[model samples]
Target: MAVEFASPPGNAHEIALTGFQNLARFTQRSHREGEYGMQALPETDVTLSAPRPVHHLGLLQIVAHESIRNSAATGWQYLVLTEDGAVASSELSIGTDERPPVLEQVNMGPFVQSTASALEGLDDIPDVQSGRYELHTLKIPALGAFLLWLRQLDGNADLFIVLSPAPNFLQAGRIYREDELLDALEGPARKRLEFDDSPRGRTEK
Candidate 1:
């Protein structure tokens, strides 16, 4: 597992991270007593979802745990579900006409405060404060479905999480949850997967 980061201007701290997943096969298990120890995988092509079982129990466990953690990320941009089925942080950015690829600029130092200062409706990550603040209740903002959570920036720009599926396998609008990604991996994913391509594929009835 390794961590990678990208920085774009304007935005505060955003992260890019890739860690291990428990996606090994069953044959790669060692048994002792009632518990089992995962065997070393000769290759990294271990599978976690069905149609095939996992070769490494440890990594699969990690992946499952990560799913739970990701399921709990109430706020944070760039929650990436990798093709290989790993969870990582991601960011979105837009550049000026002359700029190459502008990503959010943040500190490269360690031990960043979670409550980093936010820009009213602009920046989402907060600078580390003495305490954590959870929104007990608030307006729905935009009840209409969006590819990702939409944060309006004072009527100027906006920030969104932008991962979507292709249209052939599309369906209706959804509130969207992280677990739905599991469907995209093994079974038939919903139409909301490609909300960007099929904006009205699934609209409120």
Candidate 2:
């Protein structure tokens, strides 16, 4: 059975489970209680391999931030390191309302994927963590900036962490209707669109 360990949107998943011995730079987890009576800090990291080796993929850019917020911030974080083990902060957050990143800047790959194929990687089979914790390596080149964005970001009724990927032109053209990808880009694009219009958030000091 092949188990899949997908990171939650904008959340950090730990790698303390069994079978996940390949982890290089993993974040520790506290047994405190918060979300679900147990939540890990939003800052915790679950690096399976600091610089993914087998795959020259980058920081493991997440396709979802909300999941990051929920799963990562409350419990132990679990993430499979890329082959080289290099994961950046930019691979996480959507960046502050400030110089939010472009799709290409934050996405990882040339691996070429349709929304479906990419998503198919997230299947929940049986006990497959190499007899320990199941692990999957992700690639996010811009992860550093994303983390910086999270740290610098603040002030809101409830700041939301939304994982919005740019238009995978090839995938979008084939998988989704034109409008769907347009919609995905709308929020971030609109936020970016406002860059020229208004000003908010902090500058990197």
Candidate 3:
């Protein structure tokens, strides 16, 4: 099955590219040999090339073990492909009337590799070819969870695959429906949110 991605806002790519270029320049200057006071700085030459937007990162707030809230779109995640076939990732904040999109962070973590792997194996997943799916990322900060959200475009049969460094009880590379994933995370969310039966702490299921 081919994976599709949602379109990001207009000019987002240009904005992200500009910010990335600025970072690259700074890294080059700072990492150059014999630069005064730069000896102590770690060598961080930003060699990422061909920045491409991959997925729309959506934020999810876990209000309780049985409840979750979908927050506004966080931004777009771009994958940087280098000549060596290595993959890196960067985040750009969504632009608003008050400010333009800005590079949020750059990372060389499991996220990049995991996402690539997921996309590659997407077709092998059972029942994936039945419907069109748009790739997105779901981040649950409180639970330290990040997942590749394959949202079915014309149906309710969405799927989620937990990324590496998977949180407790959630296995990486496993496909889960919304309810199944939520059920598995119930214990963790309850512990994290300190949910109780008391009205003050009770979470609406």
Candidate 4:
């Protein structure tokens, strides 16, 4: 004769608890208390492969900067490397008068002809001990600057390290839109409509 175990107390619709003990093994309960009180659960081993350090971090920086520059939109402006060998992209924009500059996270899409992609075959990318790279565009390329920049970038550790600039077109300190000019005007300038000067609107003087 088989021995009958007591069924867990619950309503008729309650699900059966078959592997409850097995599930409990994975989590731990705390016995102590304080600011550093009991942990939510005991640490468990996670079977994930450690990310390998990027061999070409510097080149990727250049590519990322170049990619942003070539982009049609004033999108991502910065390429950042995380301590754990991950690359993140960001964009900086001015907020309204009530707020400071805003830094937004952006996606690092494909790197075709981008500064980051330029490191593909080059073997001499600089080995930066610090994972965080701050890029500044020293000089906007004039005329054949792109070709010259390419030539200077051929495995040159020095150039890649120093010349990473923010890719916003306005980074050169020039406004691109007519509305931007009008927006900069204060008081009467901004309030006056260009149409007011048209012949149709002019009544003598």
Candidate 5:
């Protein structure tokens, strides 16, 4: 299923605060194979939530496995949403055993660290230029959500990653240009998959 980005009318801080509040409601999976891969191994159950089955299992599996390396047990998985409240794409964060630790290690590179730093709540989100992409980080300091937007110089699809604070490190990322980085600041909330205790079976919403 695509992630839902619609939020109750409000400013960027309000929207982000609301999204983080919702994140607390998600059920936690103890098994590696449970819902959204929180169990022995992350697996997808067609009968659960999510509007459709995951089409990119290989990539997601890699991400799920990799996530463990960071000791990242708390996660908020969801679809990347646009400023206007639409699913931009599906994103995954696997648990991995490798580590001193890394952020977004599933897709490692300058983008990962740069984006994470921007959202770490140190100062304000900084604008970073990496190769052809100009990344602008938007953070609602009062709230837990931070959005990282990477616009390309060639007018191609831009990259966006929305993040919330850790413990429950939920993220939604995708490549699209329908929504401007600033517009997303106005509001942001996306739908996520829900899982049961059984690792092999999960329900998506």
Candidate 6:
């Protein structure tokens, strides 16, 4: 069974694509000029999946297990499809009242690779095979955690796949339901919050 992905909101693709095109042009020129350490560009194209909205959570929000739906959309991420698969990713900042969307940066990290791997395995999950999912990126900076948030369109339980460089308590590449993920994050979130609230932490800030 194949996994069904949700369509992005209005004009998101257009906005992201425009940003990507601009980046690609700059990258090409930079590569030719031997600038910014661009050894070579990847020979790949964009995936069929639309840009996924990226959401962020602070320590307080993570500790509270706040619903991501309440979080504002911070940015949009597009996966680059290599011959091997979706191995690279790029991001675009959300448009504001004062400005339009802008290209942020491109990433070819463990999180990107892990997200691609998780998506490849989604077809094996019965629940995912049965329902449509909207892919979203969730980042918890305090925990150094990144997750592929598969929000079930039918209002069922959502799936959160942990990416690499996660906190010790959370296992990378593991697919966790909302409750499970929150439960796993509880201890780590508390520890982090406690540290951040401490005098030493305050002084560092």
Q: Write one digit per residue (lDDT tens) for candidate 1, span 38-127.
A: 433222532221010001111222234334222212222332233543222232233335343223321111111111111122233331
Better of 4 and 5 by TM-score: 5
The lDDT values for all models are 0.24, 0.26, 0.63, 0.25, 0.30, 0.71
| Local distance difference test, candidate 5 | 0.30
Tell me the deviation in Å of residue 191 in model 5: 16
TM-score of predicted structure 1: 0.19
| Candidate that scores best on TM-score | 6
lDDT of 3: 0.63
Model 2 lDDT tens row, 1-205: 3332433432222223122322111221333322232222233333432211111111111222222222222112222333443232222222334342222112122232222233333233222222222322222222211110011112211111112343332232222222342344345433443453334333210
All candidates: TM-score: 0.19, 0.20, 0.74, 0.21, 0.22, 0.78
Model 5: per-residue Cα lDDT over 88-181, one tens digit each: 2222222345322111212222333434443333222232232354433333332344455444445555555554332133334432232343
> How close is each model in CA RMSD to the real structure?
20.0, 16.9, 5.8, 24.1, 19.1, 4.0
lDDT tens readout by residue for model 3, 1-205: 5667667667666665566555555655766654553222122433433233333322223323232224346677766555554346667876557466677876667787887777778887766777788777777666778888887878777788899989768999899887887777766766754643456434322
Q: Kindly list the per-residue Cα lDDT of model 6 for residues 1-205, writing each as its tens digit.
A: 3545555656666665565555567777888887876434443365535367888766666677887666567787887775667645777776666465566777766776777777778778787778777788888777888898888888868888888777788998888998788788778888876777455544321
- Maximum-lDDT candidate: 6
Model 2, residue 197: distance off in Å is 8.9
**Ranking of candidates on TM-score, top first:** 6, 3, 5, 4, 2, 1
What's the alpha carbon RMSD for model 1? 20.0
Name the candidate, 2 or 6, with the larger TM-score value.
6
| Off by more than 4 A, model 6 | 9-11, 18-36, 43-50, 95-99, 197-205
The TM-score obtained by model 3 is 0.74
Off by over 4 Å in 2: 1-183, 191-205
User: Residue 9 deviation, candidate 1, in Å?
Assistant: 12
Query: Compared with the true structure, what per-residue lDDT tens digits does model 4 show for residues 1-205?
Result: 1111122122211111111212223323333333333223212221111111111112222323333233121111333333333132333333334343333323233321233433332233333221222222222222111110111212233223111232322222231222332222222222233234546534311
By the TM-score metric, which is better: model 1 or model 6?
6
Off by over 4 Å in 1: 1-68, 71-146, 149-167, 170-172, 188-205
